[model samples]
Target chain A: MKLKLTTLALGAVMAAGPVMADLVFPSLSYRTGPYAAGGIPFADGYADYFTLLNERDGGIGGVMTKLIECETGYNTEKGVECYESTKGEGALVYQPLSTGITYQLIPKVTADNIPLHTMGYGRTSAANGEVFSNVFNYPANYWNGASGVVNYLLESNGGDLKGKKIALVYHNSAYGKEPIRTLEELSAKHGFELMALPVDHPGQEQKSQWLQIRRERPDFVTMWGWGVMNQVAIQEAANIRFPMENFIGVWWSGAEHDVMSAGDAADGYKALTFHNVGRDFPVFHHIQKYVVDTGKAAGAGDQIGTVLYNRGMYAAMLAAEAAKTAQGIHGTADINAAMMRDGMEALEINEAKMADLGMPNFGPSFNVSCENHGGPGLVGVTQWDASSKTWSLISDFKPTDGDVIGALVAEDSGAYAAENKITPNCN
Target chain B: MPDQFLFATEVFINGLMAGVLYALVALGFVLIYKASGIFNYAQGVMALFAAMTLVGIMNGQVPFSHIINAVFGTEIHHFGWHVPAFLAIILTVGVMVGFAWLVQRLVMRHLVGQEPIILFMATIGLAYFLEGVSDLMWGSEIKKLDVGLPQGGSFWIEDMTAGLGSENFYGFFIDNLDMVATIVAALLVVGLVLFSQYTKQGRAMRAVADDHQAALSVGISLNFIWVLVWSVAGFVALVAGIMWGTKSGVQFSLSLIALKALPVLMLGGFTSIPGAIVGGLIIGVGEKMFEFWIGPLVGGATENWFAYVLALLFLVFRPQGLFGEKIIERV
Candidate 1:
């Protein structure tokens, strides 16, 4: 009784008071915007996974998970507002899900001692853990995705691309431009002629670019598009009779909405994937039983299993596993932001662990270390079977060329470090 | 060089097609401005809302499903009854007509004597309000709008133009949807011209555009005419929305395409229907052909600025647009 009284007195003396019982995770969501088609599924997936964990396992290590989503509408300013307001609620980590918002929160989260997870996007150089210690983009980054696409292409072409002409049609934004330098480097190394074509923002019109494609007749054409841009590009490619087999896109361009409109013409259109495409995983059964079946879902219950929805689940799995890892390191279930950051650094999710978690092969299995925020960048290519309206994995989970991409990562992170006067304390 | 010119010809042809679409949206602006003297900036958002409503009604989905779920704590989405395309379109036109009436009653009724600049700002605000309401009603997910329009390239056109280019060159590529949009847009133009010239209501609208005071004095109820014009604009918005929402999935960017109509209005006089079409064609074809010829020479992506640059240059030479009334300013 005397010890409890002493603790209560100490807690009363402090203004902020006692630590919360729940682990806080702030989701920067954009459910209403120009990119709402893409954003809605991802947000639903993220929220549903956390809810599933809470409903099934009672959260990570028996602590209730608290997800307070403040809508960003995919705008950078609104993202910052959500961050500023929610960071004080003991937010252990943040996933902005937007490249522009991720960049804005990177510096602020560092100062606030919070970890920012950009996942597959934002600045590609954030893969270097030393310069971006407080941020993590584990499993993959844009450069890794770019190399993975090229590697799949190389393997498909029987390992030689000496005189192949490759064209990259990308969105005119930082998200789209992230892969250009890496693609250029790969082009030089492989002796493939690279042509970069940019479609303006929102990209509703693409007559000239496709006309150029008709004229140039590039051997391979890759795309970096989102929302309506992807569907329009697919339709245009079919219009020009461009072989869907030779046409590919990054992960963002692959989803149900993109292909459903193009109908049968989208057959054989390929894209990169960091996780399994279908809802074959055991975790989904629980999501159906606990969340959708219970009518506790955030969006349409039918959208429980989709491309971007699965991606959200993959991201939440990473975050939850990192929390478990952080709790193991700190020897306490009541983990804070700093503890979660260290936990993310030491986190690992192998095949066995995923199997144990009831989501065998649902996502890429990788280990995060102090020097590398982005884990082994393994991505597979998936093709759309328009008739059946499904995407099937066309390639094994292939690792990107670390030697070429790593050197670029170092050069970029080094430049960023110098510009920001950051000291690298990487082990 | 000869091969380059061959590609250039295709580019020019494609641009004219794109311009037809731009003109299609511009027609909505011309219809409303000529009758009411109010520049309707919400025309693009109106197109998106109409498409979303059409999709929702066709799918038998509930209106304000998101809001209802939030407020009532109940989960109800679709009614599980599919609507035929023709009936759904008719229902959507009715909804748009109701929206026109609401605008006439609630907002425009209050601001009847406001300046043109004020009215323009009001329309801008209306755009935001309409966008938000549509999102709330239909839920802002990207929806696939299929009214059974033919998609993909026309093989007949390709075969016809196959021998026109070198054997190495592929045949000319043309989307069947774009062809439909062009033919429909041409019919709309003809229908509008006939209505405006032959119908007494059209002559009354023309008189209003000529002089509002005189039109009001000449036994015309300005309120009724305004309502008629807005309903007509809403119909035009529906057509533009169908063409655009079909081309690109019905989403938020559909509204931004309305901005393209502004420069069209600048190129063609805002008050002239013919000018809107001509201006839209000029801007559309001009940007595409310019991007084709000079884009690579200057590293590409000139389409964004080329239309505005053309409009700016043309405006510098003539303060009044090509078909605008000559201004007589008194010092």
Candidate 2:
């Protein structure tokens, strides 16, 4: 009893000191693995953005934001370890780029009052406003990405999604399963037939998959793959005489590295673009002027404006915006987790402000709320042109079906909570 | 039922194409195993590295841009010395030869009398080390390897009555590259058979293959034979890499497919050239056919296990393999 009393007294004393002014980030980076092709650039871009913030803006609100990188290597266990290790250092938010890790950490982040930003991945149902309170998949979910691609195909084939056969060749994982629930729903609603093809992980050999495609002859094929698998799928599809324009990839499937692997054959392949593209934007210009030109950039020259880099920059933008909002509420950037949560829900990136911020193609502005974690589901389609070695935006932002997503989010978040054995904080 | 049969035929032809690709990979394994008992597990990695080098050189991503510029009197990013396709192919073959020579000198020479398993483990180590080294050299991003193979199928086989069926059964289409690979593989097989039968060096290699001890006792320099065999294996691996790299764009996972050749070796005799080619074709065609007929019934990923399962069954019936010499040990 005397020892317990002494321990309690020490804890109380420790709690009395002023919390250190720090913004800790739990980086879910995969630097060494198959997915490292995608993961390395993303981590580098995320890290560089934080470093730029510290150097250019004198930190977020004059208090430095510490970017703590704990490599997940794209494994779920390492992601949890990184989260647990960084949460104690006063973590502001967690952005697990992996769907598996996002599902694992949702309950923990919610219970611990740390919001997770799962951009373009994770539980498609998490896009529901009421079901997922602390989790946000802004820009769009997989379903939104799928819808954007389907819509692009519809527009290309004379502007209608009725009575079409859409095939989905996907890696058979949770990441691959994400768009299916939504795509099936869309198929049912729009009178389109959906053919699902599952490719096991590391999708290297896919001749049979392409042969099946040749036999079935689906009107369009959208792929959900990463790393070498993406290139292999494109190559196989090309070999089978599949029309390149009809093949659409998810945001993950659409990278310069992925296209480069297929060379000129992947010229007309289209994919969903959630954020700005090309290095001509003002923010990119700033990065070039301040970071690259001044020798502060972390990546190679050829890697600039790639898919992963833009995703990382967007993630950094969200974090800084949340910090700015938290400063507005708490009157300091060195706010606690609760303040960060509040800031995350209250951010408003208007179109005019986005343009002023040097992002002209920065989709739509959105704001989250206490009950609604995911902001607006807006997406645009982009296509690669091999001759120029650049991606050109082919469509404007189209609003995704939020109602459909809300129902899924409700069903999925409940499933996620139950599977992981956690209570929902819906109350 | 008719549609299913047509689909089955379609799947079979498709499998043959896939088999050709797998055979190309297995040929590399057979060539190395025939020359040296050690299975060069890093053949797939060698292919990936070779393809990466090709793409890197073509795209001006290689360093020495200033030197290339100085030599040509113009600033070039990569080896901006765009030689013709045949020259590029020749240079790649040279690279593989150099790689083989280096490996023979640095790694194989030291493990002369070591256990076979130890050498195999060394190759595995070499595989990972090469993967890391390749990534570091060529930036771990996915790159396109376009050796200017024909893109899509050209000739449309429309005469349905020409086959062993009715008007509904049309001749299947073939990609131009697939046809080229099949032709090239056939030519290489014939060329290699003639070389092994006709040339003195080829006879020396066969002597080495027959029995390393006898070959050594008959005044044959073991080191020279070993290096020669490795160089030949390296040539085979380079050709296999170019074909497969042309097919799949030569990323890191392509090396993983090299592991699939193990089961092929088990089905074919480990040391038989014809066994490797035929075994690769059988495994390839068998897996594709099985996946087509029964894949959807069992979670639709039978492509991953079908080849291994087929080889396992063959092992059950024929313990020494189809072409492997049956062992008769005397105590």
Candidate 3:
């Protein structure tokens, strides 16, 4: 109890003051824990992008964006405390990095009338803006990622997934299990045998899991792992000599930090991604000049080119763009969290906008609508070439089967709305 | 062997391999509990620190870069020279020894006469301190530590065992890293036993374990013995760190494996080395077999808690653990 209170007080100290001049974007960060391998890069990228905006463009719409990182260490309780402490400080939006935290924040943010950008993670049904009201998982969600992985597999096997055996070895938590429903739906739709294998939390010991896979002989293994789990899974996959080509991971498991441990053995491992990897984009040049070269970067500036780093930057860019849109809509420089929520509802990042933002086709361009907070659920596939030690985008961004996923989203969100006595508030 | 039996044998072999890794951690706990009568909860965190330090040294990363960066607003990452694996390990060992000395001087020495529970809590405090220090120093990014340890599955073993199962079963899939770990663990146990049985310092350690008060009466320095055992435990942690760090990249979850060792310690007596080893093997094999056979019926993923449950059951029957001396209540 003392520790919790102390952490809350510490979170208060770290939060941006409830000042009018700065747009406080409280980052629920975890730069010191099990998932720090992932969280550090993401937090760095998120902070650095805001730093870049402040330096390069003088903030979004002439208002300073204070990206105060409240260290939660990926603990859900700490995350909730961080939310409660910082929501008073004009927090424009919340990006609870962990899905577990996102789950906890969804209701809280709704009550607080603040917007949350879960971004490619969190509850897939939260994409239904009509029910969630304040929660947003724009660009893509886990359902999109799952469908994308299946779509890639179907395309790889000449568009027919009949009589195929696919296994999902996922982390046994909310974040890891987020895609089960979608995968199950896709399997039934495509006539594939879906075997769900839940790896225990942290997922280091998977000798028995692979043994079962060896016995069952699943044609393709789709991993939804994170942290040390990713490396361990890759190592175990390599140990089982599961064809690297046949095994794929979600975007969370696709980073260099995960596969580098396996070295050459992880050569042909593929993963589903919504954005392009590498430091070739124009925005990266600006980030290098404005953040890294200026020596004001949060983490090792040289690590700017990794997969998750890019994703983090993309998330920050989206948030900033939403803030800009809110400013434009409200016709005020100092827009509040409510206005920011409105701006998030009106977010649109097309090719022209991406180019204007100095990132030309860096990722799949999508728009968030009033009823659909999740943009056109588009995702691409990337393969890791250990020889070159880089990820290359292998396919065009394909839209998820929204006809199927949309129905599930509506059903799930309807259930949530009924449970919470929340009337659909679409405008 | 029939296909079903062959698969079970394969699972058992994998379990034994995992047990060796667990024993490596529990061995450190037993060493400390025996010598100082303090349950070092920070033992796992010690392994994380050792691995982080080793990786930091090898990569030539600037220590405390996070703090240094936060204070100065500078983005310096590396000193830019890769030290060889052998040299890095040696330097890391030096750091661990220095850490042991520091703990003795600062934390452990102050709480020298504290109750066992108090000392245990202090170690937990030490664990958090070391974790923060490690994160700040290494910059919290997971670094792949490759000390040139052999990895992946052994083709030789796989090919040799192919005919043991049905055509569908493509032999056993044991990690070659696990194989290397088993050999290293065997060597470590032997070295520890030989040193304790033969060397004067080791004899002093054994004496301290026997009775700290009696050893002190017979001209042994309790502080010196405590320091020596801690130093030995640090060495054991480093070896475990290297094995685990190489298997899965050195990250914070590397510390949680210490939790796994707790059940092993409970099943084995806290003061018994051989008991730690046997208890680790039993927990490992038991969990794996249970998960493989009964896990599916209960929705799988049983490896996480099965060991703890088994350990609890073991304690109900044998309170002093399998190889531990029978405990007698003073009342």
Candidate 4:
């Protein structure tokens, strides 16, 4: 009887040992290519935050996070290859920086039961919690950004946006188009005139776009550009003597590298922000202590709390919180794709926790749910000061107009379903 | 004046600057074609490689070391070296020369007397291969490159021309780098002309250009001349790369300007030194003026296609190009 009991106890110990599984996270880094200048900081922040979490708190519930990166070189085909190779290694979520690649992989990720964290990009319509069950665009979508720009312009002119002529110089891709449909809708509702000007991929030269702006003489210019397009637009606008105050860029357009080359000329440009500015945040102090001070920083030491970096930190925070929540329920470190998804859906980074984590003006108080995947719609506006080489937030917390955004999201998702021959499973 | 008019002038100037850069790239294309019958699509990638190499060397980082570290999960910072500007320039020349010699020894030497189109395709393949190898060697991150060149506007010219009030009537502004590029390009063209017309080897190159079969029969070593032409092209690429890489910093898109040069070749007859120079200036100046005067009236951004449209029109009148040998190919 004693021998049998000892053998049973040994078997139970073996079973408990197998339960402590580490979570694997794969990163598709576009640290090269035309967009690398912007992509690298975001990636660094994302990775650094995870490292900090592991270092400071011994990982999420003792389930160590491992980051395996595959350089896509900003090519869609290469991005797909990276996804295929990493997915089998137990990838829980994907954050494709490119809209084109995100669109290509959404179906595959959905079929594979993996969630895609397209943070600030990908299908704008995926903002609808009902249609895209496996995707999330926390904070806001491109349509929200468009509305934010329009709203800002309206406010700039003392709250009446009627009869305004707005020109959009955007990259000709899904990422660029995401805002156009919303702009068109808003223009019709507010009696503003919208002109769409498309720039080709890897946009470097824009002599033509500015020329058109000169001709059209639009009251405000909203740029949905990326990579080199941002600088090109700013330079062209400066040369044309376009009033810089009237120019606004999307969230992706506001980076130091984009405007640094054009110094002074890029002043007065405003861009929307889905996350709080990290420059003055206490989290940056922690980053300095934990990452930069330790010489584990990924980029130039100075780029620790840039806008992209802050967004990356937010993403990491969401993922980590989810992991913690999942461990609380499961009572073990071992996690699978399903548990990661549940953790992601249960994230609630409120102000108290944010303050405790050293982030002030960080963002809203909300929890993700299975039926509502867009974690929050919090956004703000930041203006570029050439003198300081810094972006200062100028507006209070402004969530996306959910009423209008929801309708558009539903409409877009409907169109996507029809085209792809998939039935809407909103229920 | 109307806002459109003001806007057009700005776009025109921007277009002109872009066109000038494109012409500089085309000059390298013309050099090789003038001496050898081969059309090199690798010219752009060659420029990319040269610029990247210079940046790497200046930073005190070896190319292979960066590649090895990058592939093996090691974070490699740039060498952080502050080599003297002049030394960096000289070292870049040596690197280009070595690369040209390797190409001649390994690839170009094997494909003598091949069809011009086939040679062109081979260079295209070389372009792809070089692009991949470059990314592998230098893990793609845009670096801040300061080669001690003057940047921004020229106050001297602006002040000198202030009396005319051209600054008010048209307010034409020229960048200091533009002035430097124009001056450098002129000096290089003159040097090439003197080399080809005065030197015996240059004459041999011209003789080979005139008749490859006859030149070979007369014991002009085709292999030696091919190597020389390639080396000259490499040197030209280095100069062009420096000017461009310095202007934009050593990035991948610097090579895409190769496509922009296609129009210059069409305008300048690919075999004439004067043609290349003249073609570059015309395309540059013309695109700017067109974007300034006509761009706003039509749609504002005439620069994107202005060069291509101009080249297409020029090509219609001169199929062989402005300086190309007018071959009467009749069966």
DockQ, 0 to 1 scale, candidate 4? 0.25
Clashing pairs in 3: none
Where does candidate 2 stray beyond 4 Å?
A1-22, A31-33, A70-91, A107-114, A128-134, A150-162, A261-265, A335-339, A419-423, B1-4, B58-77, B156-171, B328-331
DockQ of each: 0.69, 0.48, 0.73, 0.25
For all candidates, the clash counts are 0, 6, 0, 7
Q: Please give, for residues A1-427, the per-residue lDDT of candidate 1 as tens digits.
A: 9999999888776646324898999888988777888988998899999999899999899998988899998789999999999998899999998888888988998898899998888878888889998889888889888898789888989998889999999998888898999999999999999998889877888888888888898999999898778988987898788999999899999998888777787899999988888888888898999998887787766776689999988888889989999999999999999999999999988999999877787777788988999989998899999988989888878899899889999999999899999988785
How displaced is residue B27 in candidate 4, in Å? 2.0
Taking chain A by itself, what TM-score does each prediction score?
A: 0.95, 0.91, 0.95, 0.91
Summing lDDT over every window of 10 consecutive residues in candidate 4 chain B, give the lowest-scoring window: B164-173
Q: Candidate 4's residue-wise lDDT over A1-427, tens digit each?
A: 9999999999977765423355667778888667777778888888888777667777777767777788897789999999998887777778878888898888898789788888778888876555677787775668778888887777778978788899999887778888887888888888899988777665665555665676567999999988877766776677667888888899898877666656677798888887777578887888888877776666545667788878777777777777677777677677766677667766776889889887866866777776567755666788889998788888976766667777788788888878878776654
Q: Which candidate achieves the best DockQ against the true structure? A: 3
Residue A220 in candidate 1, Cα distance off native in Å: 1.6
TM-score rank order: 3, 1, 2, 4
Residue pairs with backbone overlap in model 1: none
Against the reference, the lDDT scores of all candidates come to: 0.87, 0.76, 0.89, 0.75
Model 2: per-residue lDDT, tens digit, B1-331? 3656766877787677767777777777777777768888887787777777666666657644434544675534554465556666677677767777777788888998899898999899988887887777776666656677775654454244236444544446566777778888888888888888999888888888888889889987777777777666666666667676676666667676676677778898777878877887888789888888888787677876778888889999987777876778899
How well docked is model 3, in DockQ terms? 0.73
lDDT tens digits by residue: candidate 1, B212-279: 78988989877777887888888888888888888777888888788778788888877787888888
lDDT of 4 by residue, B18-119 (tens): 666676788789878877777889998888888887777778875766455547856565566767767887887887777778888888888877888888
* DockQ-based CAPRI category assigned to the predicted complex of candidate 1: medium
**Weakest lDDT window of 10 consecutive positions for candidate 1 chain A:** A11-20
